[model samples]
Target: MLNQIPLEHILLLSAVLFSLGILAVITKRHAVVVLMGIELIFNAANLNLVAFSRHDPQLMQGQLFSLFVIIIAAAEAAVALAIVLRVYQHFNTANLNQIVTSED
Candidate 1:
């Protein structure tokens, strides 16, 4: 029943998700929020890849590549979060506006 929706609709939704991710990444000041935005963007990309894979029965590699992307993203998030925590510890603030300081 759900398959009635056109491929255009799925693409539109993915575009919206990607836009929201970009907005969040640009507008948010917290590192965690930025990371969340990045994850959202990654998810949007994964959705597109999966949709394409499903559309093309002969090409199943997209889904496999998306799976790899997810794994890599998870590792990236972990490392980024650790760095954020260390920055917060040293600066006593998580706000991006307040985190940047002299390079001395």
Candidate 2:
């Protein structure tokens, strides 16, 4: 039932989503928006992995690895957010440029 949709459609959507993710990363300067972009990228990767898994039934590695990737990404996001919060507390700003200084 799930195979009713064409692979081309799936690939196209994945490409669009991936491009949007790249755009988000490039356009957003806020730390949280950057994190959201990373999440989008991770989601696109998972979608591709699942699509490929559908093609090759003999190996479920892609799906499994994707799950691990999601887990790692979540952990990374948590740690990153924590660090961002600390930076904000210390510097009172989340802008990347504001955090940098020639003195440092």
Candidate 3:
């Protein structure tokens, strides 16, 4: 069933996701939203990895690498969130612009 879907379609979806994630990271002010965008980028990469790995069932390198990415992403999210929480507690705001302005 999975093989029925064309690779172009999957690639296109991943591209769209990656683009949106980049836009979010660039434009969004809230720390959490920025984290979400980063997660979206990670997911887009994972989708591409899985999509490509589907072609070669024997090697499964892409899938393994994607799994590693997932693990790293989880750890990164936890640490990032902790830092964000600490910043929020100290600054009373999650907005990057506000934080910068207050710092200045």
Residue 3, candidate 3: C-alpha displacement in angstroms: 5.4
Candidate 1 residue spans exceeding 4 A from truth: 1-4, 101-104
Task: Point out where model 2 deviates above 4 Å.
Answer: 101-104
Q: Which ten residues in a row have the lowest lDDT in candidate 2?
A: 95-104
Model 2 per-residue lDDT tens digits across residues 5-73 = 677887888888888889988987788888888888888888888888878889999899999999999
lDDT for residue 4 in candidate 3, whole number 0-100: 70
lDDT, candidate 1, at 33: 96
| Predicted structure 3, TM vs. truth | 0.94
Task: Report clash pairs, candidate 3.
Answer: none
State each model's CA lDDT, in order. Answer: 0.90, 0.85, 0.96
Worst 10-residue stretch by lDDT in candidate 3?
Answer: 1-10
Total colliding residue pairs, candidate 1: 0
What TM-score would you give candidate 1 relative to the actual structure?
0.90
**Structural similarity to truth (TM-score) of each candidate:** 0.90, 0.88, 0.94
Global lDDT for candidate 2?
0.85
